[model samples]
Target: MSEYFIAVIIGIVEGLTEYLPISSTGHMILVGNMIGFTGEKASVFEVFIQLGAILAVLILYRDKFMDMLRPEKLKLVNYKENGLSLIHVMAAIVPVMGIGYILHKPIKNHLFSTNTVIIGLLLGSIVMLAAEKFAKQHLIDDIDKITVKQAFLVGLFQILSLWPGFSRSGSTISGGLLLGMSRKSAAEFSFIIAVPLMGVACLYDFLKIWKLLSISDLKFFAAGFAVAFVVAYFSIIWLIRFLNKSSLASFAIYRFILAGVSYYYFFIR
Candidate 1:
């Protein structure tokens, strides 16, 4: 198949899975390996496409973000004591960004494999299930009401997502629930924080891999970015609606199935 065709396929996978509880990294690893697209360029392409998904979030939540950018909210330490602000999101991103930066090379070197992704998926599934069963609080339903403590704890959970198949949305949403956030609120915060997490991570990766790209690869990358952007926009909309009336239990089950299938295909085969 053409590389462009492969890019499209990967873009679809990234779009559908990126913000879902399902691990986009795991799916991309499996699909990339399946289609013989596993390599440096492919890795860079995957990271590039994530920016598209981040852009979707930025546009979808433009008003919330604009509020965050207000002059008064610009102070690094200033934030509403009870109301959500830029500080809440910062608290949620700091832990992962710090740890991820320290362990970047080691993680890329050792944990970016299919076997590890399977393990991550399985472990993440358990975490989600446990969070659902135990979190009866559901105290905070409004995103604007998220406390710094809650956001920080959620950020700590976001660290788990760096494990490739752990799923960033899964970790944050589960953490949010365990910390007393309603499902819809948790999901919204997850999507909101996802923009910066993905944006910084992708930009960092792109800087490292820019030399590997060329003008000839432009169309391939563009196709993947555009498709991922469009699909992820709808995915976000659908997920918020879904979470309002549902739970993360279903996604946990899907992770179990994907874990089993990925293990069989990649390691057992």
Candidate 2:
């Protein structure tokens, strides 16, 4: 396939999975490998394309973030009533970010492989199933009601997402469910936290690979970026609606199937 066509294909996969508790990076790695697009250039392309996905979140939750700028909104005890401020976002990201930073080198070098991603996919399905099965009863449906305690615990689940196929949304949503948030609420928070979470990680990766990029490559990157943004915009909406009436069981099943397919293709074939 032509490089631009590859970008579009991978962009669609990134958008469809990026926020769905199905691992976007895992899908990208597999798709890239199949399409003959794996390497440093592909890595940079992913980092850039993910930014487009994050932009959808920023725009969708612009009001919540804009509220953070208002000085009068952040009274000491209003965390439960003000929707989500920057504080909640920070709480959800710190644990993962700290641990992720420390382990970044080792993870990037050793774990970004099909074998490891298969393991991550299998493990993450269990996390989702367990979260649904043993989830707390008192549903904190509104993001406005989320507390620092809840957010922090969710952050800890995010640590699992440092593994490629572990799915940041999957891990953190399970954390949210286990901590008493409703599934929809958990998915919402997952998308919200993803803005900063993805932004920082992508920025860090971009800095490392920036010099490898060429001016001639801008169009390809733009193609992926634009496609990811548009598709992710709608996926986020569909997921929030989907969670309201359904459970994570289907997604877990999907992950299991994908993992099996990946293993058969790479190992058994």
Candidate 3:
């Protein structure tokens, strides 16, 4: 396939999975490997495309973000004590920022493999399923109702998402659900958390690989980025609506099947 064709395919995968309790990175890596799109350029492409998804979040939540950016709102330290603000989002990003920075090289070099992704998918699936079954408190329905404790704990759970297939959305949503957040609220919070997490990650990777890209590579990146942005915008809208009346069991089961299939193809075969 042409690189452009592959870019569109991967972009679709990234957009559909980025906010759906599925790991976009894991899916991109798997599909990339299958199509022989591995190496520095492909890795950089993957990271760059994530920015598209992040942009979708920013556009979708512009009102909330604009409110947080108000000079008055910027003064707060913990927004949960007041209302949902940039502070709350920053707090939720703390754990991932610290942990992701320390482990960045290791994750890129070693954990991006198929076997690691399969393991991550299986483990994350179990966590999500268990969280749903055990959650006793489903009282917090509003995103503003999220407390500091919940934000910090959700950030800690986000640490697990650094593992390729664990999924930032999946881990954080499961953590929120376990901590008494209603399903819709948990999913919404997960989307909000993604903006910073992916923005920083994409920027970091772009800096590392920017000097190496050719014009062709740039074209591929642009195509992928545009496609991912459009698809992710709609995907986020659909997921939030779906979660209002549905459960995450379908995603968990899908993860299990993905893990089994990956293992069989990449190892057992």
Tens-digit per-residue lDDT, 87-171, candidate 3: 7788899989999999999988899899899989989999999988997589899988888678889999999999999998999
Cα lDDT of model 2 by residue, 206-239, tens digit:
9999999999999999999999999999999999
List candidate 1 stretches off by more than 4 Å: 75-78
Candidate 2 Cα outliers beyond 4 Å, as residue runs: 74-83
Whole-structure CA lDDT of model 2: 0.90
Give me the displacement of residue 102 in model 2, in angstroms.
0.4
Q: Could you tell me which 10 consecutive residues in candidate 1 have the lowest summed lDDT? A: 75-84
Off by over 4 Å in 3: 77-81
Q: What are the per-residue Cα lDDT tens digits for candidate 1 across 164-205?
A: 899999999999999999999999999999888788899899
The alpha-carbon lDDT assigned to residue 75 of candidate 2 equals 68
- State in Å the error of residue 125, model 2: 0.2
Cα RMSD, each candidate: 1.3, 1.3, 1.4
Candidate 1 vs. true structure, TM-score:
0.97
By lDDT, is 2 or 3 better? 2
Candidate 2, residue 178: Cα displacement in angstroms equals 0.8
Q: For all candidates, what are the clash counts?
A: 0, 1, 0
lDDT of each: 0.91, 0.90, 0.88
